[model samples]
Target: MQESSEVAGSIVSEDCLDEVIQEQIKTLKNAQTAALSAVTKRRNEIFRLMDNCDNLHLVKSEVIILCKLRDKYDESFQQYEKHLTDSSERNTVNKRHSENTASIDRFITEMNNWVKESELQLTADLDRKSLCSSSTTRTKSSRTSVRSARLKEKARLAELMAQHAMREKTKVMEEQELRLKQEREEQEFRLRKKKEQLELETKIAMSQARERVYAEADNISDIVPKDTPSPLNPNVDPFQPQPSDITVDTPQLKANVPCSSSHCRFPEPNLDMQLQSQQEMFLKTQQHMTAAMLLPSIEVPKFKGDPIEFATFMMAFDARIAPNASGDADKLYYLDQQLEGEAKDLIGGCLYMSSSEGYTSARSLLSQEYGDPYKVSMAYIKKLISWSALKHEDPHGLYTFALFLIKCRHAMTNLSHMEVLNHLPNLQAVVKKLPTYLQNKWCSLAGHLREEKGGVDFADLVEFVYRKAKAANDPTFSKFALQNNYSKP
Candidate 1:
């Protein structure tokens, strides 16, 4: 029985030991699960830290690349700015240079024009002098011819006188011869008549005596008498001359006769008539010669140089031909017809110069010289203005035209005003191209146009201002009015 109890005790102890071991095992298992959780959390934290470090490296590399690009952009921007600045400066310089060149060219051109004008003027003067000299020479030659003609007429008169005297002397001699012949014929006729009368008387006496003797004898023998042939029979009186046989001698006239000096007197009345007829002829010839001398001879002088000088010379010559009178307008008109082509154009330009001088001056000059001064001056102004506008490069032409417009402003009409307006843009361009002083001067005039008022037109105002200034003896105002009045609208 004792042994059985001990065995049971050992078995109980063994059960107890088995139970403690199970409890300890449960505790260790719980500790092991908690430590595994802590290790896993640490590993996850390490992995998260490594990922954050890789992200930072990537971000830093990206920032470095962006910084380099920004630096490159800044450099490029600076270069672009520098290039733009340089280009701008260069452009400005080129513009300046071009303007300088243009101004210099303009000045040179103006100088050349002046020189050419001077040369032309000199040449014209020479031509005018030459024409005057030629005219003088022609007059001298005409006088010489007239003197020769007079001498010839005198010689002819002397020869006619000698012929008349000789003819008169011959007529006297013939008359004397005829008178002497008539006297000799009368004396011969008287002598012949006396001889015939004596013959007839003798015959009558003989017949009577014979008849008485026969009467006594016949008483005894009448028959004897009848047989005898009577004395009156046909064959009787044969000694008497028949009428057919009778001859009368005529007296002969002598052609030659001696003349007394007194009978050969000069024929004074006939001489006077001949002299009078000759004087009439001489007077008629003298009148014709005088008319020829009085007539004007047109000789247009040649001028190769200045048109202005030529115009002046031509005007003077024309004046000499016909004085400035309304009646002489046709002469001026015909004179223009005689000019052709370039000569006419040159004359027109010279007329424009007169227009530029002043309206009053142009009026006086043209009125005296041309048939229709107003019409001619207007035409000239139009032509010049057109030429200047068409050939825009010539500043001299423009300047001259502008001057003409200013001078003749008072003469402008609606048509002229329109013409001025049409060319305004071109005129402004030309004005800008002028020198600084000119520009200021023109601008001042333009200001006047803006300030001007009243109902008076631009043309009338110009005339009034000009006259007023002149009357006031204000040279500056007069000059300004002359230069600027036409530029006003």
Candidate 2:
């Protein structure tokens, strides 16, 4: 019974030992699988981070994460390796110890080699990326330097060209000055000669008048009858009256006397007065001629197939007139009188007449009839705006439209905000195509309008818009605004 029990106990121990070896193998295999999964996961994360290496900031952050993962992987792998070695030494008494130890050693060696290769690959990739980044930065710097050099050369060339142009302009100006001086000197010489001639003629006329006066006195003395007695010499003999006693009525004698010579003219005093008046008139005429000469001769630009061509020209001409005079009703009336025929009819009917209450009736008639002036004006303005916006050309049209707006603003005191708003889009479109300064000015005006807490006053807004348009640097617009006193009282 004892022997049988011993034998049974030995078999139970053998079974328990086999079970322990199997459990150890299973645990080792699980650890190895876990470690492999962790390595794979870390490797994938590193690869993802490497793929995005173009972003330095992201790559830097990923590097830190990869380092931590690598550390964790190493720790876990070392722990697994230590556990496998210990399990192999403890199971040395078991027949499967050599196989299990060899397998664990192979796995650990392979994992270690893989870790080293992966780390070396990561380092090589980082070095290559750094080199590439340095090369790209150098290339960019070189390109920028080349572009800057080109720009500088271009600026230098432009400056040289400008200087050359300025030199040419100065030369032309000097030549013009010399020519003007020569012309002025010639005119002065001619005027001086004319003045000397006039003086000589005056002297000759005075001598001739003296001789004629003496001759007339002698004739009167000879013609007087001997029988006629002088009132002052009643006591003396009628035919022997003394020269001192002879009292002649000079005024009556001069009036009744008729000169037989055709060359006889007005008295010397009257002639002198007439000559003085003529000299004054000539001086005035000379002064006017000089002023006209001094003024710059501007060639009026030609317009073809334009309905408002003459009107535009006249408006421009009016603008060139002095602002103070241009705004005067008398001056405008004078200008109207100067016009003749079709020109008179066109400008007078279109602008001058439309400036007052008469235009309202005309507009009303036109509106009631077929051709509305307001509609025509609006259509023209719309066309100008479209042209300006699309081509970024034809500043004249834009300038004309602005001028029209200013005129309308002044003429129509009842111009409403709604009316301005209706034309606001067109105005803005034209403004966009304007020069930078004008665009800025319009923007500033718009901003100011927007900032006003209270609603914009119609009259004030109209005035502001007119003033803004008048402020443009365009000479035509400037002249128009000044002539009409668009912003002034």
Highest lDDT: give the candidate number.
2
- How does each model score on lDDT? 0.48, 0.55
Q: What is the per-residue lDDT of model 1 for residues 1-489, given as tens digits with 9 covering 90 to 100?
A: 999999999999999988886676555445534443443444344334333333334433443443454344344433433333357765764565356446434633543454456556667878999998889877998889998999998899888888888878877877777777776565445434443443344344334434543454455353222333334567755677557766788664343442233333222234345445555655565556545444544565543333323445557546654364344344444444455555444345443343334323423444454434444444545444454232323334444545554554534442343344224564554445444554575566666765784222335333433443243334445444555666778
Model 2 misplacement above 4 A: 1-268, 306-310, 314-376, 383-459, 465-489
What is candidate 1's local distance difference test score?
0.48
Please estimate how well model 2 matches the true structure, expressed as its whole-model Cα lDDT.
0.55
For model 2, where is the 10-residue window of minimal lDDT? 362-371
Runs in model 1 lying further than 4 Å from the true structure = 1-319, 323-338, 342-403, 407-433, 452-489
Q: Supply the TM-score for candidate 1.
A: 0.19
Question: What TM-score would candidate 2 get against the native?
Answer: 0.26
- Clash pairs, model 2 backbone: none
Clash counts per candidate, in order, are: 1, 0
